[model samples]
Target chain A: MSAAKKTALCAMLCAVSAVLSTLESALPLPVFFVPGCRLGLSNLAVITAIPLVGAAGSLSVVAVKSLLILVTRGVTAGIMSISGGLLSLAVMLLLFRLARFGFVGVSVASAAAHNTAQLAAAGLLMGDVRVFSFWWLYLLLSIAAGALTGVAAGVIIPPLGRALGAR
Target chain B: MKKLSKTPLFAAADIFIIALVLALAAVPFFISVKGAGAPLSASVKINGRDAGSYPLDNAGEFKLVGENGIEMTLVVDGDGVFVKDSSCRDKICERTGKITREGQSVICMPGRISIALEGETGGADAVVG
Candidate 1:
């Protein structure tokens, strides 16, 4: 793919991810373990974009997604989103490129890392370590949600890759 | 690249990761559950500093103020302690429902108040990794 096309595709991915994020938040999941936890459906696009547009393009998608959240929400929300997004993308890139792991492993690891990053950011901002106390439950939820998202991505990515002509 | 007959949903690495995460998630629960019968004590902290603590055995209410001046009313009634009310925008702490067991907590993020039950099996056990 040409550079211009990759940029346009990444832009399209950002828009799709932002929409997914917004839509997923509206979902009334039967989750009571962690109050603010979601299924991480928005990560589907990020997982798909990695192999399609490479790390740089995926990073742009993350940046655009964070920017969208920053504009709509406040600064703290923006910070959390960016921290989670970037950290997760880094993990995904490493696992996908170096380890040659399938989409499932990469996406699941990325989701878990994203949650950890968000928790770390919140703890630092609040100057509290008690936040870590909830690690057990949050980690479990993140992994479980990550697995679900990873499976969904695995099911969709092969076909989507063929459709988009992505490696 | 070697063409595989099928795209396996879970590779060996994926199973290993899943097992690792499950083990990590289970460790705390197992440790905490061992002391489930321990007495319930409310440990209150404001702005991450130790504010005070009260035994849930005696039912009463106490108001705590965060550094940001957010007011939180903690009520300990028959059964357990819970956040009766909070001044924060979202009543998440209030809606956290009643926390009766050990290691349970009601944290008001925006209010910067943490009300956790001091469990006997605790003492940096949950913070290991």
Candidate 2:
């Protein structure tokens, strides 16, 4: 892809991801077990972009999405989003580039990284490692949720990549 | 980057991760669930500080004032403890419903208040901090 085309694709993926993030946050999750847990549908764009546009493209998508969230939500939410977003993006890149994990593997790795990053951010804000102990259930929940979302990302990425000519 | 391929949805590696997740999920249940007759309690905290502790069996209502002068009304009954009302705009904590199981929690982010179940089985006490 030409430089201009690559930038355009990144822009489109960023917009799609931003919309997904906002829409997911607005909806009432039916998950009773983990109150604040989400499906992380926005990751579809990042996962799709990674194979096509590469690691830098994925980071740009996350950056734009988090910026949109910061503008719409608040500073604290923005901070949390960036922390989780950057960590997960890096993990996905590493898994994809080094581990030769398929789309599903990368998706699951990123999802777990996202949740762990959020937990670390929360722990830092509260100045207590015990914050993690109190929320240990979320660790298990993250794995299950990650797998489910990973599958969703795996299913969606192929067609989306075809449209973008990234795959 | 490698070209994408159309592999089976549930690849062998995917199934492996799924099985690993299932095994991890079961550990928490086994570790937390034991001796049902044990009494249950709830710990209340505000801004990571201990607010108070109340037994789930007790039937009563009380008010918790948080750091920012935020107020939350906690009601406890046979079912469990819950937030009946809160000064926060969203009222998510109030809508979380009663938490009866061990390790369950009702958290009000805006108010910085958290109420978590305390099991008499000597499971670690729940605290926001």
Off by over 4 Å in 2: A31-33, A98-100, A127-152, B6-10, B33-38, B67-70, B89-91, B119-129
**Global Cα lDDT for candidate 2:** 0.71
Best by lDDT: 1
Model 1 lDDT tens row, B19-115: 7767877776666665555566788877777888878777898988875568988998756888876887656677677888767777776666788
Q: Write the per-residue lDDT of candidate 1 for residues A13-59, one digit (tens) a residue.
A: 98899999889766647664465677888898898787778778888
Residue-level error in angstroms, candidate 2, position A102? 3.7
TM-score of chain A of 2: 0.89
Fnat for model 1 comes to 0.30
TM-score per candidate, chains pooled: 0.84, 0.79
lDDT of 2 by residue, A1-167 (tens): 67898888888899989988989988857773465577788888887778777888889999998898789876656777898899989887776666445556666667767877876776565443334433456656666666676778777777766776654
Q: Which DockQ values do the candidates obtain, in the order shown?
A: 0.34, 0.26
Residue A49, candidate 2: how far off, in angstroms? 2.0
